[model samples]
Target: MHSKIFRGIQQEDVQVAADALIAEGLRPTIERVRQKIGRGSPNTVSPMLDNWFAGLSKRLGVANASDEQRLQPPEPVQAAAAMLWQAAMQLAKHAAQEEFLQENQKLDMRRAELQNHEAELISRQEAFNARQIALDETLQLARDQLTAMTSRLEEAGILQARRDREIEELRQQLKSREDERDAELQRRNDDATRHADERLRLEARATANEHRWLTELDRERLEVKRVVSAHIELESRAQATQTQLKTAQAALLDRLNQAERSLKDEHHAHELAKMHILELQSSLDVCRLAYAEIIKSQASQEPKNSRRKPLKQLMRGVTVRRKL
Candidate 1:
């Protein structure tokens, strides 16, 4: 980015050119300065022109210039030039102070904007954190509910097992009762056979003792009635046991149905919780994407904004430099 340079333009060259322009009764504008010096940026030459004009005005006994000079003061003009230089320095300092203040004001505005952006970002982050925590709590609650449902299912399984064992025990007791009834029936049959044989023997042997035979027959009849009564009682007990078994089976079936219903309900609740979680996750994703886009956009714009025009001019040497 180097530009063509003008050779041989020294410190005295600017003053000599300005004096010649003044002799021609023309204002020593930068255009006049560059036309005489033949090379320099507007930034380099303009301040030199301001100094030349300000010095000329001071030689005529005026004061103040907002610029510096390359022209050396002659011995005759030294005291007046020094006063003029001081006034010019003061004017330049005031102008620089004004520019600095203005720049600071701009910087303050930019900082305030950045601060506002930061506050907004913090608010959004806090909202995100709160929402995430809420989701976590909800998920935890769902997990707890699922755990409870599983525990209940285990309890139901144990209850079903207990019912099966109870039913098995009742069946064993009913079988034992039936076996006892069968044994009693066999005993009654044998007693009937013995009584029949005794009556027949008595009939065959005793034509004398009719009163004793009649008494033995009446005793056999009473014995038969007692066996029948015991059979009836056993049958009643078996019927009662069957009723209890049926009731227990029905109750067990009801319990199974109730457990099934509860499991279904729990499953439905679990499904709803999952759906809610999914919805929250979707919302969170959307929010994250939006925030990411905002940050990306902000990042993209910042560098463009940071590349200031004054800085660019300085880099390109469009402006002059202080010698120090």
Candidate 2:
């Protein structure tokens, strides 16, 4: 991995080269050696660098105290070391500046990505709000329509109930009228039957009176014949029987006239009774017909029940008037 990052040589190979160089008494900084030969195995290269630095410091008679110590040398060695240090410092400065620039570029890319994400978030939020508004409007419309339908359904139920009540009331009224008609008819039937029975009794009584009058007439005729035969015997015997015969004839005529008068009176009473019976029968028939007519009229009127068509038309006219 280190070889790929630095290129051309493996980390182990770099470590071996750095170690060999250090063993020949070369002193190098880890960063400088990394630039030259790349980062090597720490176990091999790190100790070599530390040892070389210690040996070089001793050879140059550097102080043991920790400070920003410089290498002091013979005049010729001092000039060479100063030049090398100057070059190494310049290279390290250039590498640090390059790393700083790369870091700044990375920060700029991250800022651009964050700005784009914020803009996308704002767009998504606006779209979500618009969709929410649309959904609320749609729900409100649905609720309004549902409320209107429910009101219409309730009104329809009320109207149906009213219609049912009206129909039931009409049926009850018709039943009451029918019961009244039936009662009237029964009364008329009873009266008619009574009249017929009375007429029959009167006719039978008239027939019995006629039979008794015929029997009386036959007995009176036989008595008159007997009295005439006795009167003839008395006349032949003596002239003095003439007055008794005249008296007997007058009594027989009187009795016959009385029976005729009684029969005529009975016949007149029977005629009067028959006339009364006929009058009663006529009255009963007229009453029955009137009752039947009443029933028919009531039945016909029951269906109208105040005439809904006219009422509806009137209501419509009123509404139109109000609108106008």
Candidate 3:
């Protein structure tokens, strides 16, 4: 029942419809055919195919010169020629669709590869930023340590100065005591020798105490000097460390700047590539439109009967050559 209904349209008419669709840049696959005729399923396409064959068979049967000529060319020849033209056009559309599909696949693959490259660049940039942050923290820590060492060194110097002042005052007090003791001895010359001996002994004891205090002060000063020297050495080391840190930071900054520049270049390249892809897509669309227009123009220009004879002859020759 379905075949009978679809057979009513005839193959030649189906071929013409297919040619028209192809000329309009529409592909004529089974699904497309079903959609074009507002039907559903592969069953619909099968009937359409049967109808197409029936129409082509009738046109081929009537191609031999016989009966009355309705148009400039005989009806049968024109119909057969139109059917062949439609078939040829459909074949062309199929080839174009296949080529277009392959091109789209290639474009999709290239886009994926570019996206992956962009992702890797982003990851590298993130890692560089992390390293820069770490370097900055390290530099800050080194600076803080250097500053603390400087403050400690200053405190040590102040303490050493105070110790020197105390030592000087003690020396002056000892000198005055010795002068007083000598004056007392000169004044006591008419007195007893025992008192003079006792006075000398006391003065010697005072001198010994002064000498001991002076030695102790010298030792304290030496100890302070050692500490100050050690502190100065530490300060010098801190300064060296600070200098090294600064140099390292500078180098890191340079590297970061270089990376930033590289990233900028990459971004620019990606943008350019994106633009190029867009232009290519636009060109492809234009080419497709031009192709469709060309097909339509050719279809309009060529006579229905004249277009198919060469191709039919070629096909017949191929068959004949195969048989030979």
Best model number under lDDT: 3
Clashing pairs for model 2 are none
Q: Per-residue CA lDDT of candidate 1, range 123-202, in tens?
A: 65566556556555655655566556556656655655665565566557656755765676677567657788676666
- Model 2 gets an lDDT of 0.51
TM-score for all models, in order of appearance: 0.34, 0.35, 0.43
RMSD of each: 18.2, 53.8, 10.3
- Score residue 189 of candidate 2 by CA lDDT: 60
Model 1: pairs clashing at backbone N, Cα or C within 3 Å: none
Query: Per lDDT, what order, best first?
Result: 3, 1, 2
Give a tens-digit lDDT track for model 3, residues 83-134.
7766654554455455556656766675676667567656666765676566
Q: What is the C-alpha lDDT profile of model 2 across 90-120, one tens digit per residue?
A: 4433443454455456555655655565566
